[model samples]
Target chain A: MNFFACENLSAGYGRKEVLKNITLSFEKGRIASVIGPNGSGKSTLLKCMGRLLKPSAGCVYLDGRSISSMTDSAIARSVGILPQSPSAPGDIPVHCLVAYGRNPHKKALSSFTKEDRETVEWAMHATGLQDKRFLRLGQLSGGERQRAWIAMALAQRPQILLLDEPTTYLDIHHQFEVLELLEKLNTSCGLTVVMVMHDLNLASKFSGRLIAMKDGQVLLDGCAEEVLTEENIFDIFRVKSRIVDMDGSRAAMYMGVA
Target chain B: MREITDSDAKRRLMTGAAGLMLLAAGFVVSVITGTVDISVGDMARIFTGVQTDGMYHVLMNIRLPRIITGAFVGVNLALSGAILQAVLKNPLADPGIVGVTAGAGLFAMAVMILLPSFTHLVPPAAFIGAFVTSLVIYFLAYDGGAHPLRLILAGVALAAFLGAFMSSLTVLYSDRVQGTVNWMAGSLSGKSWIHVKMILPYTLLGLFGAGIGARYLNILMLGDDVARGLGLSVERVKFMLTMLAALLAASAVSVAGLLGFVGLIVPHITRLIIGSDNRFLIPFSAVFGGIIVIFADTAARVVFAPYELPVGVVMAFVGAPFFLYLLSRSSRS
Candidate 1:
């Protein structure tokens, strides 16, 4: 069975539907990237998948169970989400904020256990945030702050990690750094990694599978090399581009779209 | 940085220790000096199962009630202020500033004037008024969500309106105006064990609720979108917070009659020391609020000798500049 599946899903804000009739399934332990334009509902779809937003029509299933019927804490234990903008109150330290991710795992009046502390430490280590653990989120650079939020999500010890524009404000080096960390997390920990990315190059480079979306519908879904063809790019993104094999690999690079 | 950390720990220890010592001192001073001043030796003797004529009567009846009332009002105002600040997501949001106190006071006075026999009706009536006003402010501020600017604007307008209503009510009942005026000024004079007993239950209940609710308040300070993203039912939490805040204010209004800035200033100071962890902030504010009120009450009585200034007036004198300073600092930040 697919780890996460959306069947005939429809979702949106109050009245307007942002995503319509979307059907997709994520395999266990695979890095999947959804790429689209500004208002293509990529972020919205991710939110619905994470059970942050209620699906207006149809249902989302996680590991054969319907997501809609699941309790928040139950879903939280299985799935961790890093929002586009994860905020902290005042100058809250990274360690303290990361400890909050363990909230779902905590029973009422339960203090942090040795295992919980170890997980937090491991998360911090994985995200290269060991040195900056005591620093406040507000004090860190944008990239470091993003990593802190990721570390927090990691501390949930989730089977699936969903990210919304995980590399929005990072420099190229930091962007690669974050994506590489996600890659390691996918390979080493066998996490079901899914994210929405705007940069097609980064999406192609990092994600094993790519799903292209347009106007609230999935236009193409396949392996990164197959779906990211010049003709498919033109059809979905409404642009012209030349697809070239980069470094003798099947992964296609778009020179430009005009 | 190391030196600063040490100093910070030392400063906190010293400050908390000083506060504790001063609290003890304040209690002793409150016991020793009152309407009829009792000597320390005689006071000691009275405590040690030796009953003296004037000292025993004075300590048991007058001084004890006054100090207890002062302490009760102090803690009530502080906890209410802290909760209000957290709820409104503004350091400046207090019972007095938002007109909850005026609304509560107005309802209580209306009862006092129209139905003098319903002495037990005051706290509940005040609580209802405060709760209703907070709900009104919350609804007025609710657009897609309760925006801070809108909430504050509504609070300001409502406070002004309620203040006008309370003043008008006082003028309307000019025959019993002194009693109304004294109550409005936040005096702890002439209070008995009954008044002490009356506020204790509500204060205890309100503080207990604030204690549990403080964790959510810490989450709320992170902003609504993030809070919602974390699976905290945002609107429900806000409603719960506002109600908790109202309870704090209403219970306080019953005791101190619209004591301002205890909710505003004390919590801000506590936040500066302990950070915004509600677990520490709420209790610390309660302690500081109690101390400030006791200290203020002491000054209120002794400052003008026999002619006692209202503790509320004394608090305003101390709290107003601090309020302005904080206002400017927050705007700048």
Candidate 2:
């Protein structure tokens, strides 16, 4: 039973249908990545599931309930989203940025509670940012800032965390650092992690399941071994590929020509 | 939560206290010193229901009302600028620059110049004008999304377009434009108790609105997608804040006659000291707003004694240089 699912979801920007009648579901405690070339509706599908964009013709269910029927606060409490380029004031300290994640759990005019501070501290500790809580965003390195953002998402303590291109601007080492952090969170805290990634090899290596899209539709879905086949790579990316087996996973390497 | 000593919070509170003290000092200085210097003792006696000197009429009827009205107008303008800056996600967004206050200026000018018989309708008319102009800018700037640059451009265009109407009114009714010159230049010369009463409701509303809206403003600076991820109703908050800021600017323009730069400079200065948090920024801006205007208005009254200058002129002269100096310093830092 797919509790967190998108049922025949179709969505798009004005005059352009980007996500065509695609159904996708993510199981609890599993790490999944949606991979596709530019404009293949990878980010669009993630947005629909996260409820940032309302589906035009279908429903997204969060734990057996239609997200459309749920209020934004209700969904926010269950799922946290980190956008492609999330920015805060450069002058704001890391801890303040993380503290804002408690907004969903706050009441109007109420002071930050004891529980809120503890959650923020836990999130900081989890992301190894407790030492740099006083550091401003402008003062942090690229990987530190990205980790700070992840710490903010983690502060919400949501069951499922959605990220869109969370490593787009990071170096390779930092990219591995973020994915490894997510992997750790999945195992340790049972966070169902879903992300939209452009790096096919990284997506396949980091995630247990890979969902591939092309032309606004999901064309392949399975373990990386099943989804990274040569035929599937060409169908989704219009590129020939050789699937290489790593130590315990697979990485699809692009070949010059078919 | 047992509130612990967060040094940041404590320092912020101290900054707020300092702003309040400055405002209090400003009020006393603004009230007692003039062509007729009502001593501090005499001023206290009048408040305590004691027999007072001849300056009592001038104190109650002239200085107190002007000071109060100026204080609230300052509050209105500064709060409006702070809100607009956050709402537009631009540091430079101000009521005068973004065209919100110019809309109020146009309508208030119409009432004063053309509809001279209905002079009392100026304040409400200004609010209507500001509301309509903000709506126009909102729609014109919004295309699939409202970028900060587009919104600023739309505001500039509409402000200029509305400015043309104001100039035409002045030229067409040149014969009746006698007494409004000081007002057009943004003065508080003849502002009385009635003016104070006229701007009170909007000032209170703005303070209340800014208080509640501060939370949303901080989240909004996170961008629409991130703010939405936090469960905020982004579109609704944006529209509400735009309207609130417009009301604030309109209220000030209704009384002070298109005072410019207070919103832009005051909030930016306050942010340098208070950080980007809106909760403290709003009240701090209000206090500093009152301080700057009161001091500037006093200087306008006293420096060129016996001949009053428009407070707007004084503000422009002082604000422009100070703002640039701060800008240079902040960029280096």
Where does candidate 1 clash, by residue pair?
B81-B263
Measured against the native two-chain assembly using Cα atoms, what DockQ does each of the candidate structures obtain, in the order listed? 0.29, 0.53
Q: How much is the lDDT of residue A238 in candidate 1?
A: 76
Write down the lDDT that model 2 would get: 0.86
Candidate 2: give the clashing pairs: none
Once superposed on the true structure, which residue ranges of model 2 sit more than 4 Å away at CA?
Answer: B1-10, B140-150, B322-333
How far residue A54's Cα lies from its native spot in candidate 1, in Å, is 2.7
Top model by lDDT, which number? 2
Candidate 1 per-residue lDDT over residues A1-258, each given as its tens digit: 487999999999999999999999999999999998889999999988987777899788998999778776678778888778666664677887777777667654577799999999999999998888777677888888888888877888889989999998789988988899999999999999999998887888888899999999998898877888888887877777777676744544455665
TM-score of 2: 0.94
